[model samples]
Target: MKDWNEKCAVVGIYNAYNASILSYYSLFSMQHRGQEASGISSSNGEKISTYKNSGLVTKVFDENTLKKLQGNSSIGHNRYSTAGEDSIDDCQPIFAKYSLGELAIVHNGNLTNAKKVRKNLIEDGAIFQSHLDTENLIHLIAKSHKHQLVDRITDAINQIEGAYALIFLSRTKMFAVRDKYGLRPLSLGKITNPDGSVGYIVASETCAFDLIGAEYVRDVEPGEMLVFEGAYSKHITMPKSIKIFAANPKPCIFEYVYFARPDSKVFGRNVYEIRKKMGIELAKEHKIKADMVIPVPDSGVAAAIGYSRESGIPFELGIIRNHYVGRTFIEPTQSARELKVKLKLNPIAEIIEGKEIIIIDDSIVRGTTSKQIIKILRQAGAKKIHLFISSPPTISPCYYGVDTPDKSQLICANHSIEEVRDFIGADSLAFLSLQGLKNSIQNAGEEKFCQACFDENYIEDLQE
Candidate 1:
């Protein structure tokens, strides 16, 4: 299924003997976040070394590449370009040299005011090397008058607007900071070294901790900065008014809806469990008679199962996804995209022949994919097709990190529910209510979720 891709995933490790290797594994686990590029930077006491390329993490970093990035502290990034052209320079863990020393930075989330910041910096004669907003942040840090790297980062952050979960590395220290609103997520983990010493890790999601045998400690609070000096981690506070609008965090609700992996615990809740709850809620909202409930595989599996259990409809593997299918949205032309959709999923004729099927999906972005799937099911002789979405209608484009289509391109943003159902050729289409979506996820306090894509109640002032 084609869905909005998350902008990136970040991992930072300190005081570990084979920091680069661990980072490699961490990025490997979160490869779904960004498939276009992967990178890692390691600090070996006196200088920082980096290796990055456009490809999957396993394809980009082999044993030889990891060996070259030797250090006891490292930072890594997996990127799907949201703001910049996909190029060598845009692949992250972007390094820069300033008067202080060598510094490298990796970030997740978009800086909504980066265009303004870039214009101002250009007027001040700052030379930017890449088109990425990440590079804009680097320029900000490099120009700060503060002598200490942490202080410089804090100063730079105060000047920027919008969501960020950033990790910055100097030769001796590693720092992790979250945007004041916490529109994106970053987690802290603790692991034991081979020598039994403790090491610290920070990643976009807790699933990264599980793969590396680290125990999750807690989420890095919104507006908080964590400094890792050798084996110790400390909280650092900066100037007032750094917070723009939100007094507390408002993490992107879409993380639970689609972006995050089911295995991940994002924004303090298990994604799989939350997705299942959403499915249960969807089932309650829209009662339907169907022989079986099927998911648009991989992302929609959990929700489909929950719907099946709650509605007394057995779940079956009606539509199977081709594991090796390339991302269809990235295909260049209309014909290529249409062909890609057919190649990516196929319905089981035997199971679908006479059965009334209910297809459960996270959200409908453009409705093209949904239309294709319904057509395929009908061709396979499905008597009826009903589509149920786990989240409210996505009406606005997400400005934080997710690479969403423009509001004009979004089907729900323009068409009513009935119009969308007819457009996709489904007998019925139902979406979970906003209240049901909030109640489905555990600990998703009303104030903590950024539902801008659904309700357009953006936390940040988009006006310049």
Candidate 2:
């Protein structure tokens, strides 16, 4: 992606009291997914209430706001800029009131045909209040002739071209749907309360399941719609007859390598284990004589551990990251991003002053951040810094939910491996092979996840 930020998480809860608290907890667990904004929409049998703002979850909501959102069924969202610029109006759980009642929707992933859809909707007299793709979905569903909400949703989804894992809140029932290719991760789980009532949760990742004391039931099947009716649940899988643009199912490979939390499982694969194996394979590709292996903080920690274990090199926390930095993309300018990264990360001079270090990271998007990081290590008196990427170079842009820039925007696409190494000022640099990446996720089931960003083998026609 052209230095674009990642999108947020969509969470929905059903048949539970203190739904606002559950929303708070779910959004908090997914804070890493998006830090730009947080929102919640709840229904208390009679009316729907919503509160959303452009800020971190902690800063956006308080006890009074939670108390005000009294409802038994609710949906929450954490946002990173995707279709819209970073503004409070773009914060989600976007609600639209129409003749058929009110609907609130939270979405994760991007809609490839959103611009076209928006123009069509506008021509048909539908006014837009925000730049989110979810609003387009709401309008599509509202305009569909189908009466059943699931049928209308299916109809609307057939027109959308990219990835989406959505949670829709109607007057009574809550619905969750995943894209046909299953590009984004969504799962269903349930929690049992002591008051003889049950609660159902839908989140972007399984880690959210653990936080809410919910047991994961199953992943939302591709091209499936799930409806929870407070006491009963129903599922509908779109018929295979539906003509979907079939590109190779290139789920964002970055999710396995970096974006997902280590503890979470994506597409039946454990992220931590997959990342560790990537490191092992990376070590095999480029053997380096390093005194110690150091990860570039949080995202690289799992791979660094794996590299150390495989190469028999000691692992050290040579760099520390400040957790307080908000989303880097939200900064108004490039200079701000540079300054934030410097402030957020500092090298340990004592640990790397005279050491030959191997720095492991997930991927290098634009190479700007990596360059600065390497500069920091060099200034810290490191003898040598060899950089290893856990995944293959991202040459093509992502057309799925991920907000990747045009192919020309990818630094690696414009520069050779040696050029990138020189630009980053690393002694040596290597990326995990495509085969190595697939091998790393051996436990992730025989069917491949999406590797289109690295390998231009898409299962579906993206240009359509």
Candidate 3:
């Protein structure tokens, strides 16, 4: 709860050879998006088959389970439980049997109007099966009087409000759509089959495409739906695009700051380049003199490099993270929480001994982690510790699928910058300004983004 939790990952494969295997690889590449559970649904122009469980993709499915999928089209999900309770029923792709044949869906965002919609459905004598708002789609689609599945989907989406990058799988077709606000990312790709045919892949990140030997095609436009029909063997064409709503894109800005992989090209900009720019911007804003610059590891490496280059400070990988650390079921005691931090990230005493160091980090939520980090650095003989945050303070919680702590739990929300610095035991602390963040991206043109966590500007009414 202290760390900024993650959103889910959704992927769809249309007409690909061994579609379920490709879906498994795509989900594997995007494991950072979610790690709680993974599942895949496949259709071979007959009955739909789905297999999923509460574990990582590797543990959830093996060769035997994937062999049973038997389909040329597939949809997959990796969940971090932004909306529903952590249960077997909540794992996706949520399979259902309705009047319109068999259908399965994978979703990647939160529904802000879930309460009101669920209330109306229950009053209308609809029995629910799961805690997921995604299940609401199944109910709404099943209840629709519309004759065609496409029309029914439009009707169902019209009734919901919030962030969603959705992929719906049917017996012979696949559909991908993003909410009008586009608060989550979804990209399109093309895969060349061994038989000289072309298949299409859609995923939450471009890195998924790379892993499965798929080439990036573009992002799925906001407020648009792509309907994939016909087999890929003969007539391989683009998915039919339906403009469900007038374009009003407001993609999530935090994708660049934290969630997305550095190698990804989100919203057509390289994530690593944008992150480096954020670091350069932070360095320009704060001209603190330090003996050396150190990154918090992994997430902070790019930004620390930018800062080091800008400030002429030597950059060192002062912290090393344990890649093998897995979550422990029994939560550590409050007094012993620092041990958990130590287990994950440890300082290099040789690099920090008697040195005035600047530590670069992406963002601070509860301040506990940063405090523990600073404590370890001091014990390593750091003379002065200056903490530099790459992004602006997270002052609000995210309702657009990201799992963030409430405002009351956000240390930066209630405390002044200096007060936070004192609490973290850092000699100096500074965060990137909103203007500086905007200046980091190049030629962002005519595009709007959702930075609600930093600005408290909720795009859609949370109560809606």
Candidate 4:
């Protein structure tokens, strides 16, 4: 598997007086999905107000910004660049004006056919405002038959290929749709406001529901369209009723492995539990003798715990992460990224000294970060270092919303496990098997799950 970095999350809400507060909370819960940028849009019955910037959620929006956004309905986004550069225009809740009225859209997942769609739209006199694939969706809707908003949305979605879970906001209504394959995750929930009016919330993961005290509703059915009016909700069935593609059902496995917050319940499986099980499985497969199991801060904590429990190794927080670090990947230069990683993570020599440490991380996309971490540990006097990845190798690039590199850029896709281990300077390296990864999520039910990024089997028909 290779190390590819692409990810984002979206949250939408309706009928809440403090819509900005709820939006902030939801985005805060999904902060792990993306650290590069955060944006939010709120509708105050008359107009829509938005606030977005190139930074983490808290950094982008503050009390002053929230106070300025007066609206009863809102949509928010957290982004990690899968496509397009990190810039202000690329920030989400993209707005546009058309005959149907104004719309603000925030989307999760990528469209494999985005380039083709954009080309076609451009030929038809549509001017693109940004490089994001999401902009194509808005134009598609504008050009479609405008008999009804949902009908237009359905037609636009039918032309899109790859993973997507989108929340569309119109002047009077808020709607959400998930791709037929369910390549990404989307869920719906409801909350009660002080005035006794009910509020509707939609988010990429269940963790967002916890922040605003919204109850967990069922996941948005793959290929399902959900419409939330002021006080009512409606479900639109898929035009073509289908579940798993017989050829392949590849949901981005990374969502379960690294991208989602540990507290999230994705595909009905608790992310923390699944990650821990991956660690346990990795330990079982590798059987390495180590003095202590240490995690790479937040994302690896669960898996490290699992590895410790399964391997009977003591767990220690030998590496501390500074939560305040900004986006290192967007540091503008290689040296900047290296320096940022060092500033963000520091190995506690007192805890790691003389210890044979097993470091658990969700995945290794490029091997650069892993190499740096291992170097830090060795420099801190760790006798030996072992690396355990929770998910199987990401051999294939993701066409879905995730931001994986092209085939030429994926280091693991071109290298063997031993090669990757040697490259990272780890004494040993092991990844969870595909079957074991599936087994970890078996509690979620027998319905199929997408493992395309691990398997290279795209379930959606490219031709369609």
Candidate 5:
């Protein structure tokens, strides 16, 4: 199946005992954001130390390993390659030693202007350690002649453009910043110990806070920088001169649709509720006759329930997904996709036999997985298959962090609705209208969202 992978997950903790262990728990909860590499860096009030490797969090760190990263302040990352080649050297939080001091950074979004910035930096005789965009950020911070650490970070970010939720750790303090557009999600959390001491957490999602018994604070504002010293944290505003996009903040709508866990609260709305509303809206937009409403499993479950409720169709587990499908599967191809469908999901012959099925899915990126799944259902005796996508058709490739297929490769970008239906071998196919999608997220707070994938409305300035 063609899966949509986000760039990474980041966690920062300040004034916490066993900061590395708490950071480990936070990263474990957000392992879904990235799977290629994981790392953590800690500051013990005297020196900054780091431990990182290319693997899952569980595989990268153990009990003794966390103990070695002793400190009351730490930052961590889980990475999926977007800006650079996947290798041990590219793993984060990338650490550096400079004239100012020791610093470590964990970043969660792609900088649209990184290449231009890197080129200019190289022209000035700056050396780069890795191809990762985060490495470029480290370089930017190092070059800034600003005396204060926060001022240097401010200077670095002023020159770059794109979506980012960044966490920076120094020998004495911790810092976090979200891009002006807020295209990615980041939240602040608080954990109170029995002894009345308070600890702070910053992560890519609130689910990370839930696992560690931390209380969810509010989201880090777009264009806002947060500084943490011990248990005290303060907010700093980005310079108004650097603001380039429309003044309105635009978050990534794909987070609610697919990337975030259903249990998460993103952009100030519950993801599960928003997805359910999306499914309901999709059903209202397209009324179809079907014997059962079945989901693609996991991602489609909440939306499928809403669809079944709205249409009065029976909801059944027509397809069972294998939870043990690992990253070591064979490379994806036409034949491999077919084989993968068989290995990943099995049709419940008793429920699907002779019944027309309406399969609800979040979105179809390439249409290969849906096509193969329909084939499997047909082979199991499904009389007919109709596909309903909860979100609008994805027609543009995302450049602000998501690892998506190029525009030329996106099925919806290249084909019409009927063409996609035919290619997927479905009896009929319908996608949620753009307006319906907008209505579904009415409760997602005052900020607008980046719907570039649905409509070619790039929100950021991508030109060099």
Candidate 6:
């Protein structure tokens, strides 16, 4: 419900008997990453077939379509369009015929150099079909003079910059690659078939592996590529790793704060544990007096629990979210806007009436949603609302994959904390300190993460 949107999810299955089925299930598991479109492309050793549409995974693919995509290797994607127009033509698993035979590609992050490369490609007489920056890759691979697919991929990799977790599927092999900075996430896993044969899977999140019964191996390292090749039909060995670029890992910190599923392990840590720790850190940072601790439903639940545990305050689900509030309508009027939020969340007067409550949420974007939430609690007869966020106030725009508005639109970027507190109608408002966020991570190694959204430090150029 907040403004930040995940860019996409990519899953690749190799040497599995039901590669298409496994891909479908993995995409379904990671559907939280993207909802605008879903697609899969399968390769049966000699040929590659692709199917894509603009909708949720379940709505886009069915038994009939899955049966038609018969193959032993496949790659799939769920897209939220950070770099493309919202159209069927922009749906992913972009398949094409090229000099290196045929291949399909799925990508999970935005490319910073796409416009320059696309313009160069266009000047060289390349005709474009889709608005997706991912299409820029297809052209790069197709036009490369390298004799082999891997070499062509390396050539293309050299031409692109910024965040990307990409999966490339050919007529016989599959390749998974992560950018030098690891701005987005992608994990590698192993799947043991019923016949004792081994297959491979790589996905945007480890949660995708859980649904398909794949064993979690480890994260694909930054600037690394895994090349998968073997005979068709559920028989494959471990992938060949190639170090393409020197590692400079700066994985997005927002994955722990919002994008990832709580149960999944991202960047060598469990998201749920980190979130609970964030709540604990929040309790330590903010000294509050309240009757109860409450969550804003869904994303705020875990941190609220941690806050309650740390502060010895009772926790309550004061706000209930409608799980089936699927399709959204345009709200042109003020009344309609309130109705839209009310349709998703309504307060429980029995628990909240005349009670001083501490409400926890992930982050505030434009401040309108937070204002509406506080308004609803006021109407429910709550005595006071103390609003807290688990992460540092988002002050800058994200240039990697996360969908955020410009600095002018981010409320915290423009307004003071006191001003924001008054705007949202909260008695008090506080955000977790940047150090608190670092403490929640529980990092034991030298693992550094991208906090560009919290602190403006762009490793790449931000174009005008």
lDDT of 4 at 460: 48
Taking all chains together, each candidate's TM-score versus the true structure is 0.95, 0.92, 0.98, 0.90, 0.95, 0.98
Q: What are the per-residue Cα lDDT tens digits for candidate 5 across 272-353?
A: 9888998899999999998999999888999899899999999998999998887555886768867877888898999999
RMSD of 1: 3.0
Candidate 3 deviant stretches above 4 angstroms: 460-464
- Candidate 5 achieves a global lDDT of 0.87
**Per-residue lDDT value at 79 in model 3:** 96
lDDT of 4 by residue, 104-165 (tens): 99988888888898999999998987889999988988888768887788788888887888
Give per-residue CA lDDT, model 3, range 1-464, as digits (tens). 13876699999999999999999999999999999999999999988899999999999999999999988999999999888798998899988899989999999999999888899999998998889999889999999999999999999999998889999999988999999877889999999999888899999999999999999989999999999988734676889999998878788888988899999888778999998998999999999888999988788988899999999999999999988778865567865688788888999999999999999999999999999999999999999999999999989998889898878999999999999999999999999998888888878765578888899888855433
For candidate 3, the C-alpha RMSD (Å) to the true structure equals 1.3
The numbered model that scores best in lDDT is 6
Error of 4 at 59 (Å): 3.2
lDDT of 5 at 248: 53
- Sort the candidates on lDDT, descending order: 6, 3, 1, 5, 2, 4
Candidate 6 per-residue lDDT over residues 1-464, each given as its tens digit: 38899879999999888999999999999999999999999988899999999899999999999998988899999998787788899999998999779989999988888899999999999989999888999999999999999999999999998799999999999999999988899999999888888898999999999999999999999999999997564446789999999999889999999999999999878999999999999999997889999999899999999999999999999999998888766656878778888999999999999999999999998999999999999999999999999999999988788788989999999999999999999999999998899899976356788898899877754332
The residue-by-residue lDDT of candidate 2 on 27-115, one tens digit each, is: 99888888888999998877789999988899999999999998778999999886677778899998987656888999998887788
Better by TM-score, candidate 3 or 1? 3
Lowest summed lDDT over 10 consecutive residues: which window, candidate 3?
A: 455-464
Cα RMSD for candidates in order? 3.0, 3.5, 1.3, 3.7, 3.0, 1.3
Q: What lDDT would each prediction earn against the true structure?
A: 0.87, 0.82, 0.91, 0.81, 0.87, 0.92
lDDT score for residue 201 of model 6: 95
Higher-scoring candidate on TM-score, 5 or 6: 6
TM-score of 4: 0.90
